[model samples]
Target: MSASVKSPRDPSTSFDDDVWPDSTDVLIMGGGPVGLSCAIMLAQRGVDVLLVERRDFVFRFPRAHLLNPRTMEAFHDMGVAGDIYGATPAHDRWRKAAWYTTATGPGRFDGMKIGDVPAWGGGPDAERYRSSSPRAFANMPQLRLDPLIHRHALAAAPGRIRSRQEVVAIEQDSESAVVSVRDVVTGELRTVRARYVIAADGGRDSADLLGIELEGPRDMREVVNYHVSMDLSAWSEPDALLGHFLHPAGGARRRGTIQALGPTHYNRDSEEWLVSVAAWMVEGDPDDEAALFASIRRMLGLADDHEITMHSMTRWSYHGLVAKQFRDRRVFLVGDAAHKHPPTGGLGLNSGIQDAQNLCWKLAAVLDGQAPDGLLDSYQAERRPVVAWYTAHSLENANRHPPIAEALGFCDDEAAGFRGLEVFVSETPEGEAMRARVAAEVAHNAHDYSQLGVEAGYHYWAGALVPDGTPVPGDPSDPVTFHATSRPGHHLPHVWLDSATGGDGGSVSAHDLIAAAGLTLLTSESAAPRWRAAVAAASGNMPITVVAIADDDAAWTAVRQIDDDGALLVRPDRKVAWRAARLPADPDAELTAALETILRGGDAPAGDPAEPYLRRIRAAANVLVR
Candidate 1:
């Protein structure tokens, strides 16, 4: 697990089709980052999983970017964190999210400088961000991210991934789901049966085949992505990764975005970039390369002599949609198949990664006969609402764009816009006022890039979790705040603890204890023996383990929120399944009952998980006090 890395196998590498297996424990469709992640983590958990992707390899275009810290923690659990970290530019290279009037200046009075803000793991909140988790964020695009995830999936189970094979139809009965797959090149069909199916086909092809109906808007907005190789070092900021180029004549409604697609080395010096613009109603042809080039030159202030090489211009839709439900008997929807979002907050891919993480363990438990079939119901209960909040938050982030443009005087009124633009960077009192206004607005955009609470401290209720009757902790409504607690149905607060009470013990995050991929019973040293005895007597050979924190370990002692004899039962996904304030009269029976409740399916607290978060989403998105 050191920094040393082994070359991962390209997902395009062929698996033996001559001996296609007709059965698997889990069949994952779509080999994008989410599907590949599912395959890797499920295989790591000893599940018989097979992955099928229509494309021979992952698309090279930079699609989803900015793997948030929460996703990185999940990636760490999947054992691909090291590779993910190794594959990207340094966190500092692309840590600044800067805004500008245009790619070039209109005046010498800070003309191009609208304002600046730190992104990812930078700025005033950096320490607070690091305090919650052991892992940091990554800025690699999906084009580079997919193969790293795929490599681990292949390494975990060779011959498990089949490319160029597409799922045609799925029929589920009482036992397993029968899937009809077609080999794209040969036009031959293959039949496979699986206890569970993960539809990661981005919802386009697989949702209908499985008789699933999607709710929410479709084709909400059009975003054109231009992949081009250009030298932009002249106006590029040293520490910025995303450059917001608002047109000098363009209003608050329209602005151009430039994202660095660093192939290698530093992102500030990346040779390739993804330039995009959004339009509710476009006038010209959607694929007008000439118009796009003219816009790019206008945004970047490219000279006629400067050569611009256009690689490809992709026109994609921005829809804020979520599936009605995640579970359809034995079939589950994940990734784009489950929901889609506007690419403002970078929550789409991260949400999908977590969806797979939440479901795989439950699947393993049921397949191993450790949990009842009812456990599967928790998938939608626990995951969908989080996606709902992400959808709302992403829209909120998208909406932040216009206000920033307005502050910079990018408007339709020609004279008013020019006057406001001139005063924005002027040295007079009016100029100072405009400068301050733009600065404050640009800083507010931090919620789009560095909103820690939504990504890491997402609150969950119901489904697989056994919620103790307690009020929700911290500011659940604040999208920018995260407070670590050990309450049941909540993510276990992370704290570094020593292996032994002696001062010489090795340090590790609380997450490392659950590395074995099962329910972990965390108890203090004084209570360890009793918890161990209880687990031994009532585990029923389930994949449960008990760990004791030393009495001398202050970190665990502070966050546990339980008595010396109490314990917390954590699911494989790292959420607290149950909490015992103190030793039960019959520890064995108490432990057994908790397991039965979780495995047999317990009713979550009554409420729509999206309601409270939606209220917070509607609230002003400001930097919360950590």
Candidate 2:
């Protein structure tokens, strides 16, 4: 049968002003995307969950613009990606990362176009992105994404989210744990207990409650975001996702960048924007509003009186901090509580959503008596390596920026001026050399922009999945390329499957065939009869679905890494738990052994040997930790 497509529903549930529950099956701290994702994912699995947030309202900061394909695929499974896709701007509205000497006015430089490249996973590379996954990277910011996720979370778990509530205290033993949550609005205290606690609190306190130390660099550097609104429709601005306004004297701190907020056009409709500039440029002892206005005008090459409205000025730091351990007894850290990264790669949020996805299923299985406590340990084993690699990756991306200035012949302090840029763009031989150098540097920096491998190709070397002992497919070291395979511990390769008889005539992603809350056994027609019978016999109290390929799904079967008479078992999170290359003589016994290894942690690592490599990766980062 074709995979069933779930229709969207109204998230009609409300939790504001509702009384607190004394207990739940799961307690999720923090109401950011990660916590909400945890609540939604867990509730859909029939688990009672309570999500707590310290803020009284959904945060409106317009941060984290890129939703990578892997994160989008997970959101698609949760039923919220459709609405996000519908609301996103068209491709042309945010396709390029174009650099400029300035946007307009040409006060110091003649508004020369420095360079251009495709941003995110679109434009000339669109096919590469499309072929890798079923979804596109949405250039949706949190100002739009968070509220939608909050609404879906309400629907997924009605009367379960409590804003203006914070986890003040937490203590856990082997049996159950207690968390003291305080109502920030009413100054009232409430106590709740849960079988498990997830600290997705974005480095607020839950990790502190467990006394977990953050390993690696602390404060790398500081940058300021100026949320301003202006009418740039009169300027000669072209389409771009991000506009890099460059000038040699600007230094790394003063080089300005503009992020498109969007409504079909960059200048005509993206009236609001977030600007990155040096903190010192806008900082003054007496608060020089006139000078600040001038600095903004100079950055955009606008005249002195350009009528820009300043909404908010936020100053934040970049860090490469990872919690010493993600799991401690019954409390597990998810999202920022577990790891922090610089925004250079726009991966902080994408990795957080994936963290929730990885953790919630293991939680559901254990709570339902379907898995062992040892299975929970796999969360750290699978995810910590990713956390370490990304921390280094993001810091490397941040360091890649200043070299662009150098490549444009900004080496000497005296030569770093508008005249230097003019000569560099000339048709002279010196200009050609400078252009080549700039292109090489920009291409190097582009790794941060289109890291499809880091986004999708990441896998576990030591986790819950039963390894086939074959070498792990794909270059785990390459952050730009993704190699699809059905190796255990890797995401099941995505392929469109034709419908089975007595089913809908449409084709769907093989990933969609797996249930959100169960095990799914995918077998070919040649192996269908025994696999179905074996699943029926072995499913017992667990939710397991059996799907037989329609014999013509060459695309789907080719990536299975299994024989026509073999089968693959997919977990609730769509991870391939085990694969049988060929049908065994006793089908029931084979299926039973696979489930035992997966759910019971039959072949998981005995210790955290991956940590030494992770520590080395962290130490090698070019980050400045205070």
Candidate 3:
């Protein structure tokens, strides 16, 4: 197969909704990594979901190889991170990404040590991630990962995932969305009425139906990817780990320029590999298979006798686009349908997974009548800005690569010319200076690998969150370094603490204590009974659980940064919704008011002059009791 292979039919061009044959709380329109993730998240909350995909089976092309720590955390919450980890290549072999001139011999470039273990997050930063969450980043290509995600999603909600099913048309009213779907295998058409339609359909028809445009640059660059399987053990040292292959400029056998992708295979010991040739790095048509093969062979410095089986070759244009709106009435867009970015920072799939995590719980809450419908609007308000930041960061990273090319003597500087391989391989003074410059450039590129800040430090403001009038100092827009904080709207900082179970019990992550469905309240040991009493007084009215850490837990206290007598309200997505530095004099009144405001989507109640907020709260309580 090659890049010219056609995709499956468009699933949102026609509507024949004459017969209604199905109904579900959520109708997921795509079963890629993000759709599967949305299904798992919703199913775990006991939300009835139907996931449909146009493709009959999972695609085998390897894409999005790096699953960042934040993505792994979502998998951990879904209880499937371990399964994903088992499928990934060994971390020790793939974590340290470096640049090599060729696959064989002593062609290692000096200062080519781009970063340490967890190529996405280097040594010290990776250690910080370990302390915060149980999951670590891993390198598992989409070909292997999709099936695992599919299996887990199926297991989470049996008989709900439907393959070869395409959604052809969607129309939504105030109450529900009616979708017309066609069975790809049988040419059968059916109608489904879903309370909400989640369009994770990979940036195609669904986005157009909702009149949403992916607004940004789509022609940043073009690149050709070659998926192959070949034995390269002769070129690697025993137990050797290989990552990025930088085929520097000017080699006798080289056809223009090419670079082999590392981390696509299990390791150098494995036969599976995916090599890429960026169009910006070369001067020939990337779609030409013969030219691509010549470049690959030249980059490998291998003999024609070597065997390499080609699986597929595909050309993709790099993009940095996000949908104009993530939601439209009863339909919502997620995953690639919501945003698209180049793979430079590996943010695309991970951001989509997190988007699913964020929206699913809110949907579950609204569908279950635990929270008002207005809460749904916060999804766009919170996610759009964060995704926009990620988009900019990825584009910046892609632009940064040209500087590396310039340092390696490949740019259009006629005065410098092509230095050839000798600059990186030879030990002469000129070679040593080139290595130093390359090393300095590599050091400047550290943000690409050590992006702990981007992985964990995102915060939400003005949506589904109540500010306590405390000003939180702003950090850098990019992920240079992470600052741990439990401020309102920030994610709850992770800390290890002794279980409130007793004096001689095991320890648990503060993250582990958050409610999977409702709001969670954290208080000091002395205020436990008061908070519990306040919650009980408001019982049947609000969904909340109270946990009090012993005042003596210094580590937990410092990380949370809250006074012993204060309280912190955590949302289902593990973000701080509100916090009180100290107990309010009227805890019950304060707690009731907060719950009412949050449930109304962080707005005061409407239309009633007689205690509208209180009246709505009572009405919801009465409904719950009924």
Candidate 4:
């Protein structure tokens, strides 16, 4: 049924003050990637979810162009990764970005060559726990991807996504959140009282009602983005998405041409091929598609025989801002509502998708009464800092002018700059190193998500899972460097464990094992007696899994024996909650303490190594020696 048809509100039926007839466990105020993702995950957990969008349909503008590995893993869980992969054309995966002097100038710089395969890893195995796949980024535009996810979310729960329904106001209390939405087409007003309200409204009209302010530079720069149809196959250039034009006079323009949409070529006889171009405007006429096309043709040195088909044009402002706060009572802001950044590094959409994944599980746990309210605080604690860091870094990146533009060889340092350029092009080791260093400086930027800690190494400092500052003897740096480690606040690094038990002979990832269940306890087999008892108690009381490892096993030796660590508690999100050298006298007390910390979102108890808990395990000696 069309979303414009509003559902009638009945006055005869009794409804709670905080909730209405169409009220659900979670009400998502945005049908973009973030909101849709939340709906997909919440529905999977059996929580009734409603996603409302202001637009009539998914937007077709290709805003975001990169999807990171972390987001891909989330899609894998939702069972739509394969569908997205199949629907996306192969050419879309092979992207090439470059820098140009102007809309019609020669090339100046090229994007760091991201190889064909994902730099970290791809596929189902990459999603395995403890498996930190090597691939980092994928070149997929949001215009094509958002629709796929929206369809999947609706399929997961039909009649849940209500487009053309704009949220007007929100009222929240200690019990629930009530949102008043209007059906734009029917002019009908309906109130939905939900257990939780998510503000994924992307800084549009809805976020304003919640008194959320997006603080940052609104107009850092103005960019013109448009999709145009033109025939340029005669140039015989490689099918690279990004092309750079450098005008001898000065100023530059970057064009991204999609030679083919997915696997199929545009019907040349009926419809022309499309290419997107973005030019930095100093000041001039906005509706200059003819001038833009003429510039492109001059840059490509093509004849005037090509026809121009202007599809859509949009003017956007680059603003890097984060909301004042992500949560205020039962209303929580996410995605663009939480943060917005420049498209320099293409981190905006990926960051929002991460926000959704981070918030969904916490919201579900709170609704199901599995976790305490404090868990929600981690969402802001973890993501807000990340958003701030990336935004700053992106602004820095955008401000960096190309070496060619800075030198202005034809002017002031003309001779020295030309000489330097000659030296830069030399084949000597120093020359090669100079060019490589410049490329490396641009490519290996500090935009590494690892630094933010939200994507990989974020640890809970104030909440229930804070660990006691016990000194475990192991290389702290190694955890962040070589492989994933179950360090406090860091995602447990993925490792391939022997899958002999499952008759697969292949390897299973650590993530798949621990993440399969809610909370997991990894303990030594020597402590199996106490561990099994604790497991029995925990199983009866709460959702938990206990994995016992023998002292002699190599895998156990590598993990448990390293710091003489006897056991480690992993949270549902795959972060370490607690650790001990040996089981406490009353295992339930320790288990309860750990569970309470996680549920309350408090740090684990702090204490000195109380002799037994601090004892070191010796494999050769076959004894726990303090």
Query: Model 3: which residue pairs collide?
Result: none
lDDT of 2 by residue, 1-626 (tens): 11222222333244556666777888988898889988888887778888889986556578787788888988987898998888778554476677776777745564667777776776777777776777788877787788889998888898998788989998787787899998898888889998899998887787668899878776567766777788776555567768777676565332667887764454334878877765555545414566666667777777777888887667788777877788988888988999988887788999999988888888887877667788788888788877877877777777766667767766437346655687676899988888888888777766777787887787777777788888976676677887888888888887765443225755577777777765788888777887777876664345566778866677876678888888888877777888888888988888777777677654556576456546654664643321
* C-alpha TM-scores of all predictions: 0.92, 0.92, 0.85, 0.76
Best by lDDT: 1
Candidates 2 and 4 compared by TM-score, better number: 2
lDDT of 1 by residue, 1-626 (tens): 11111222233323575777778889999999999988887777678888888888756688888888778988988888888788777556577788776565444432266777787777776887777787887878887788788888888878888899988889889999999999999999989999899999898678778767766555656777888888877774776888886654666665578888877634546788898865532336656766677667766666655667888778887666777778888889998898887788888899999998888888877776667888889888888888988987887787776777788676778567777877875789998988888888887887887788888888677877677788887777567778888888788888877554324565678876763455888888888877777877785535677878887787788888888888888887788899998899998898888887787667865777766544544342332100
Residue-level lDDT of model 3, residues 180-296, one tens digit each, is: 988888899888899999999986779667778776666556677778777776654333333454444532111122222344444566667777765544446666656666666
Kindly report which residue stretches of model 3 are placed more than 4 angstroms away from their true locations once superposed. 1-21, 90-93, 105-118, 234-242, 247-265, 280-289, 413-434, 499-506, 539-541, 603-626
- lDDT to native, each model: 0.77, 0.75, 0.70, 0.57
Q: By lDDT, highest first, what's the ranking?
A: 1, 2, 3, 4
Q: Which candidate do you rate higher for TM-score, 1 or 4?
A: 1
Q: Which 10 consecutive residues of model 4 have the lowest summed lDDT? A: 617-626
Q: In terms of TM-score, which candidate is stronger, 1 or 3?
A: 1
| Model 3, position 558: C-alpha lDDT score | 81
On the 0 to 100 scale, the lDDT of residue 437 in model 3 is: 75
Task: Give the per-residue Cα lDDT of candidate 3 at 39.
Answer: 87
Candidate 1 differs from the real structure by a C-alpha RMSD in angstroms, to one decimal, of 5.1
**Candidate 1: residue pairs that collide:** 203-337, 462-604
